[model samples]
Target chain A: MSLTRLAIKSLLLRPARTLLTIVSVAASVAVLFSLLSFNSGYQEGLQKQMQQMGVHLMVVPIGCPYEAASLVLEGGEIENYLNESVAEEIAGMEGVAIAAPSLMHAIVRPEDGRTDIYLGVDEKHLELKNWWRLNDGEKPGPGLLSEDDAVLLGWDAALIEKREAIGERIWVPEIESEFSVTGILEPTGTQDDGFFYVPLRTAQEQFGLEGKITAVQVRLTDPSMAAEVADALDARFAGVEIIRMEELLGSMTALMDSARALIFAIVAVVIAISGVGVLNTMLMSVFERTREIGVLRATGAGRLHIFSLVWTETLALTVIGGVTGLGLAAVAARGVEAVIKRFVPMAPQEAMTRFDPHAALICVLAILGVGLVAGIYPSLRAAQIRTIEALRSE
Target chain B: MAIRNLWRSYERGSETVHALAEFDLTVQPGEMVGIVGRSGSGKTTLLNQIGCLDRPTTGQVIIAGTDVTALPERELVAFRRDHIGFIFQLFYLLPTLSVAENVGMPMLFARAHDRERVRAICERVGLADQMTALPGSLDGGDMQRVAIARALVNDPALLLADEPTGRLERQARDEVLDIFDDLRADGLAIVMATHDLEQAARCGRVIELRDGRRLEHAYEDSWPKAHCAT
Candidate 1:
């Protein structure tokens, strides 16, 4: 019978208390895991989204910058647009490498109630989006759209509306018109993978807005001069908002930083409470076994032995709880991700509830540390007991 | 084992209580020394010093030819582990462990891992049939027997028992005394503290204590009775 066995047996003697303590510690650990993983996933998702967009500056009508960015970058309802002439003006600006304009509209098919995104762009828009590749069929020619009504389907759109999409016309109930699919765009693993593309002039004609557009995506010749160029453009276009990509990234990072701080605070409180719970349980055990400890001492056992018994019991409880909590976190994270996707369709398609090995290791080490600290006071109390005094205790 | 001028005192608030003062005694191998005293007579204090469970405020306790009183706590613990065993008045068996597990505790502490010795000692104490039973299921006499088995499991040279049969019936008390006699016959030293004058008279030497000091006429010629068959 090692001290470990003795400790385990002691805990088993009071099975109810032992189980309750384990559950308490496990609940705290699960909360910590969930919060930490969410923070990591949220930050990683935002960074990927920003990096994949591949634009330095966005020019949008005043008060519609957010709505325009959400539509182009996340694919959703849009009720705003800029004049088509704004794209030409921005293209002729100094230090501007490419100024691509696009118009975004969504139509719901009555047959399935599924919404489809229609993004109208000029020939320069394709060149500006360097990641876009033609998977099959034909690429559009270099010009604004004409009366031909040719369209290119996004990878996801092509898959959903397969066969009927290629070399066949798909009806748009909103506009009461039909357009021929000329090509299929390859999967870019971005917001663009779920949209349909048509020439800018065709969208303008179909929508009865001959000179209107949605937003202008600007690529700078020198990326470092983005702030200066954006300021110059902001001054020239008083009715538009010129947002630098770096500024947008910085604001998003700041928002996530605040969220991370709140989560970290919550984790700290939970760890502290669990630590106290461990201490309370061990102290109660010691109090109940005071005379038993005295007997052990009288029978050639030492203070170190008493200390080890109490500490071992605490460690066993915490370790079991921590492992169970981690397993629960892994399972709960998947459900949480699903709930987030159901409510927010624009959420990152990649897993947003990540539990990497590094995070898991840190969580385990931290819980063990809590166990050690929590066990200290009770173990010390056990070690300091006088054999005669303890035996004399009723 | 010998004690020399051992004194133990405590400060209870503003008053000082001297539990033991100038306590001195000696016992040879195969000796059964009984300590007789009233409630505040310091017999328990003497046993504590000799067992190395506590340090005396003043004086020396020499066990196995070493001054255990002078040894540090760490060394004293190891010394106790190798040489001494103790049986208590209440028979403080762990309620959770089986009789065998309770008896095996001393060997476990010694890291001996000798299952045979534990079984042999349990059998010697007549608890072989109750090896797998928890202490709660055992009677007072059986519980005391388990404590005795635990004490002897480590095969220590000295055993200190405080009121070993205090809670047992007359028949059970006689059984415990018989076991003590058998232990003494096997060349192991034994020290017992008891209020039972009949049990004290059966020892090779009896020491009486009062006001933390030894009485001169503790042993008498008439103490040994014909009915005592040790």
Candidate 2:
């Protein structure tokens, strides 16, 4: 039999201790794997969310720009509003291609245990959101919501409202408005899939916020002219703050990176603790097998052989733990993502716990590194055992 | 194999206790020798020296012409691995390994493991049916047989057994002695330490020790001869 097989068999001799040690390692590795996968998934999801927004800058009423941006991207009622005239003024600028004014209002129904978000927009808003596709083969653009009471339902909004086909009527109890569903947007895997679209004037009048919009999503004809356009808007608009999308993305990513740093520290501590558990288990095994090691020495095993045998057992423990941890992480990704969203601010609507093979590889390598480090002392102790003394040990 | 002026001492607190002192022995190929001594009489110590498991305090253990005491630790290990084998009284077989694994352990360390040779040796030791069984599942006799099989797996020139049959029943002890007889007939030299006088008489020559010194040197034909030495 090979040293590796013998080492594995030795671990099997104390099944409970071996299993407990492996489980501790697996617990740490699972956390590490989930952290790595979240890191990759969060970064990618944030970038995708930004790209799907299809706007170079957002002009909102002076407040916390990040909170205002979050409220606009994810549908929520804003505490402040920008003048509706800002959209027309921005559209008249040289570099600005489209300035889509929007009024977002959320009606929280505690009894229903849900919040209904209403987004008010005109044709220019649709022009900026060119990626929106309508079900029932209808084109989503300027005339989609031409009627005063016409509403465009997002994929999830239609499903929740049970209004999938065109010409379906929906009654809004909070706003006391009855509207016809002219079109339903297909699923876009974003926050947009959960919003109800209405005409800007209708939403303003019905919500008693006439002549006011929450934000204006601006797309520039020349992307490189973003700084010039933002500076011009800052000078022109006294009550509105211009938030560049790139700066917003950088801020969000930096926030996530800080959170990730703290989590990585925690994971590191956990891994270190698990490494100690491995060392302890191996040390106990070595201590218990003194006479057996002596017998091996008597049968011609050198110090190196003893060292390798013990070290190989340690590696086996970690490898099994690492693989089991990976599987556990994969199965629990959804639950972990939900927990992350609860703690992390501005979490993207897209999933943030996707599987990444590179992350898995890094976790495996890290486990091996832990195994190597943890194996050293125990293996050395086993190897340094004097044959005569060991053989005489009870 | 020859041992010259072998001395083994241990420091207990402020006192130095000699386990084996000024001992000398010479055994020829194909000869079976027994070392008889009571508790604390250095029988195990002498076997440890012969097996290269322990070093002499100040002496030479020349096995197959190489003075093992002079060899470096690494080369000494190689020398022991290639030329010497040992069987312990307690039959310290690894519980994790099966009988076959235990038997092939020496060959595994020597980097010359051969499955067929391991099987042949197991069969020779009458452990052919118990090859796949773990040591914990085997009786004392079967366990000792596995230990014996492991010692012989390397095909060593000198086999040092410390109370090989000390833990076995009468029937098993006789069976082990018969195996030793077959091994000696095959030209393999053996040195065994035992407390049983009856068992010691089965050897070609027997050396008796007391207080780390030789008490007598007896032969099977002569029955016993008193040869006391310090």
Candidate 3:
């Protein structure tokens, strides 16, 4: 008997039109919600990865430093190498705390349908990757960096190679070498979980790439002096480029912001279309119910009553659509993340879309705003209907 | 209730057409007055003016000592809500609403819903068994009864019905007229427009119109002591 109930019943009278309008709103809202969730989750994942890196700058051979840094962090074969002496020279710099030089080589086994990534590092590299922890029951010493022919297996690598216990030896067919496992690193939720770590000299000698390393990861005594130290490194190093981690983060975020702007524009257009659809549906409902509205007027309903009845229907449509859209976004988050990764540069290993309550709330408010705007004209048209004309309408 | 010198006109292209010209009528409480005419005879127009659904071009409509014609649109709506009720010839029950809901609609607009009163009115209209049924499921008679329950839910001083039984069968029409008889006996004034001369004859007084003007000869011949002021 309430206006709201009456409005809902009216919408139910034309079930197909109401459902179609709701689905359109839901589609637009789903896109908007996914965009917001991806924005928040991508930024958080990027910042966490940067913090976990524990390095301020990286020195790589003269090339696209961003590509080189990504390759090194993600364990890919490098086309060029930097001399191991760069690590020593960077370590001697005034603000440098630890310069961890690492040589990354990937051995692709097409027959096995997988690639094995090997990282050669000295003791300083262990300091830069301070989050690494040895597996349970393994003695935590100075690690395997100083041990000859000793290899530390990442959690996933150990599982794959069946080398779960200390003293287990793994034979590398590519390098024609057999190395004993000194430790197994616990899962670090990063690319490190899939790498095999060996002593720097042993890898250099076994791979026949002596005194050559892929990159030098540098931690600073004071992070604020990053620009000055990068300048000093640039001036001193002839065949190397210094890539500041903060600058990389900023550039990547800016790139994502641009992509987000494009996506937001698309979502805006979709939402506008949804609003138009709602307006059209409500307008049609008003036209169809002209005589009914006249009967209400004759029964003592004021203009406000008629107006609010129509307005209530619009709002009901959007609120239902908004909630349904949020559920759709939540269910499709992983699929959306996979598709986004194909287009976005340097997507993190972790999930890129997160369910945020605040973002959901914003989407709800936006749809309600859409409802308010879309309902105005139709409600006014219904309200301003002359009673006699409406009653006379066929 | 009193109506004086009422005029309702419209312009079709360049010429003016009066729907109701210089019409006047008065009905006492507890009286049932019927308005009868052929097509385009201004029966609906007269009811619209009396129900405050339309404004007369020049006239005074005084109900309960207030000149409702002079009230603003907002107050006029409130006046209609509080003092007047209407039933249409087509029944006009909202298809989506159940019988009880249709009856409670006027109270919904008035912002004062009494479940007891709605039930009582449904019972009075012999719709007590059909309270939960939707209008679409009801026959024409039941639908008309629901409309009657809706109009009387507000306890109005005057009721205006435009062709209330125009679409009903003979049995249904008699059932509706019986409800009107009970309402008139309860001291509620009613004005109905109908095309059925037999039904109009049962009213305390019947007024006939032609071309928006009263047919004085027909009125004088039909009822010698007609109380209406022409």
Listed in order, the DockQ scores are 0.58, 0.71, 0.71
Tens digit per residue, CA lDDT, model 1, B115-168: 788889999999989999999998999999999999888888899999998999
Q: What lDDT score goes with residue A309 in model 1?
A: 82
Candidate 1, residue B77: the lDDT equals 81
* Clashing pairs in model 3, backbone N/Cα/C closer than 3 A: none
Per-prediction TM-score: 0.75, 0.81, 0.82
**By the TM-score metric, which is better: model 1 or model 2?**
2
Interface C-alpha RMSD after superposing true interface residues, each candidate, one decimal: 1.3, 1.0, 0.9
| Order of models, best lDDT first | 2, 3, 1
For each predicted model, how many residue pairs clash, with residues at least 3 apart or on different chains?
0, 0, 0
What TM-score would chain A of each candidate receive against the reference chain A? 0.66, 0.69, 0.70
Q: How much is the lDDT of residue A269 in candidate 2?
A: 93
* Tens-digit lDDT track of model 2 for A102-152: 988887777777778888999988888887889865569788778889899
Model 3 CA lDDT for position A100: 94
What shift in Å separates residue B22 of candidate 2 from its native position after superposition?
A: 1.4
Candidate 1 C-alpha lDDT tens digits along A1-394: 7878888888988899999999998888887887677667877887777666768898977775656555544435445557888899999999998999988776655577667777788778877876566785345445323435778777888887873345688887678888888777878786687888888888878867678887899988887889899988988887787778887777877877777787788889999999999999999989988888888888878888888888998999899999988888898888766754564324577888888676678779889999999999999999999888888887
* Model 2 error, position B66 (Å): 0.5
Against the hidden true structure, what lDDT does model 1 obtain? 0.83
Error at B159, model 1, angstroms: 0.4
